[model samples]
Target: MKNKKEMAKEIIALVGGESNIDSLIHCATRLRFTLKDQSVAQKSELGKLPGVLTVVETAGQFQVVVGNTVGEIYKEIMEQTSLGEGESSDKGSRRSKGSFLEKAIDVVSSIFSPIIGVLAGAGIIKGILLILTQLELLQKTTGTYQILNAASDSVFYFLPVVLAITAAKKFGANQMVSVIVGLSLLYPGLVTFMASGEPITFLSIPVLSGTYASTVIPSILAVWVLSHLERLLTRIIPDVLKLLLVPAISLSVIVPLTLLIFGPFGIYVGNGVSSLYNSMYELSPLIAGLFVGGGWTILVMFGLHKVLVPIGLNDIATLGSTTIFAFAAPANLAQSGAALAVAVKLKNKEMKSVATTASLAASLGITEPAIYGFNLKYKLPMIVAVISA
Candidate 1:
């Protein structure tokens, strides 16, 4: 019955208060804790907290599983403990004392954690469409297929909006400013420049050019920079004019700066990654596919897949399309096959239930549960699939 905030306070108290903690981090479902003393930390006590699902002491860290809302719980804990007190007066100061990695991870987690459900749900729906289309049952030209594709693809097509909101939250900038920056990418002039194919000139500045649809690095980086600039603008300006003038000042500064710096920088980074991927492809398509598809699965299992998702998106945007999608497709298929294999082979009720769920999740292109839950538990088969693929 207790709220996440209430439970966060209790966990902070149990972990010898906020001061005893050297650092804290979190994954999709767990609060990874590094404390001054593992013995005094009392993982058992923290595990008993209402919101906590489980406790994992692994690799010299005490991980408290808070399910999907770990970020919200973390925010409450930080607020109650004044964890970011020294970093920023309003918020984000709690782990100001924590290491750079802690802060970076926290920022990343905060941005993606809230939107993960939507991402997974959309991805699942898209996966179903892919399966249906590939099976020759649902023609892409059909009205039903078109409508379903549109419904599923909306998140990806307008991904900048989602990133804008989350990035604003993470950067402590005004949501509207972040949104404005995202909008700039879709501006008429920008599109006109792309249409003309005559070298993008940002205010006649000859800006670097690349499509931004489904882009990750550019928008995220732009928003991050804008968030900081917005903070500075918000810090200044008269109190009487804070509301209206702040946004105006931020957009004036950020939009121009975004075109000049972040936009080009993102384009370059995205292009660089794409080039690197292609250079490897020149070595061998089979190698590239294996690396992308099979290697990617391994990375996703450990939550390292996010690093590549941006790169893959960047490739698709800068270049026309990608084989990375092909790579990703196989991992899903392999997980699905492995899960189905388990469902057929296993008779235990609990095991059957787990396998059934895993099979469905994997079939829908969500292999993490299979990778981390069932596949990783039964190590040999996971190894075999990854190797054969």
Candidate 2:
């Protein structure tokens, strides 16, 4: 295989050179690029690259699918270019102005993508710790176990702060000020007061008491508001005092509003979305299972699959476990099994090799390579995979 640096250079050249790129970021799997001229990138050529699994264009990004090695590729890509500034404006871009759903997906994906690895790691540790404690292999009361448990829980506990910083970047808000707001949510005094169960009142209006830790919606919504407020403050505040006043004024206005309005509103929104999903699942477990299982790959094809991540995470945060990801387990099995079948039947050596590798990758729970690289290329296999799912 080519070194990552070489692959990065080739990929860069294929994506209309470095100059066409407005911003570049990598999720767990794909290298997401916001290009100045989308038309200039050679999508097909990029997909044909040795290390690349496929190329996907959706959610306002020229997404190059590199599978799990995307982080290493991203590092190489960064080293090769000066596109690390992370300027995400669409100024002079050819893509249409995004709809609300599109914008929301972009924001959500951007915020979650970078931190997902850490989140998953923390979750794994928590799961392992739970299992060990239940089995009596590890005593939960031990100092070692407590320290490890804290490590596992820290990510969720500080989720709002991380989300604040990431969302601020995505929404063009002041990052530090947004972080300050996030920090305020978890302030020791506030936590203490909240734990006391005493009523909180601002201007004689009672504050709804809720823990912001491990919640997704509140910080994201808060940052979205902060982005708009920052823009307004920047325009009105004088140049000399602009930096100082903008952050101060934005925080002063937003922090109170977040505690009073946005925080509870976001929780309500999460509950509503969760409720709708639960209602759907309850209405027809079989059909819902079939639809999610059968069309899982199709959803990923259109970039709609990411909508489930937050839902699943939210469910875990609120309800301790999720039903959503259960459907995906079967989907992965069906697709990988089909890919393996195709690999066994294929005549071409190259096709057979790719199919075999993709099949193994899919069985290991990374299905993009198999789905995009093997199944989709031979339409019959992809169809059979969906049917089998």
- The residue-by-residue lDDT of candidate 1 on 1-389, one tens digit each, is 48877788788878877777755655555666656676777777775666565566544445676654677887777778655544222332223325665455445554564565666677668879989989998999999998988887777777776788777655656777788788887777876787787866556776666556666666788777766665676678778888898778778877777667776787777788888888999889988988877787766543445555666656655564677766777887887788777767787987788777767877666665566556666787688668755
Candidate 2 residue lDDT tens string, 285-373: 88878878887888777556777778877787788777787887677887888889888998999888878887887775568878877
Clashing pairs in model 2? none
The number of clashing residue pairs in model 2 is: 0
lDDT of residue 183 for candidate 1: 81
* Superposed Cα deviation of residue 246, candidate 1 (Å): 1.8
Model 1, residue pairs in steric clash: 83-94, 84-93, 84-94, 293-327
Clashes of 1: 4
TM-scores, one per candidate? 0.72, 0.88
Q: List the lowest-lDDT window of 10 residues for candidate 2.
A: 88-97
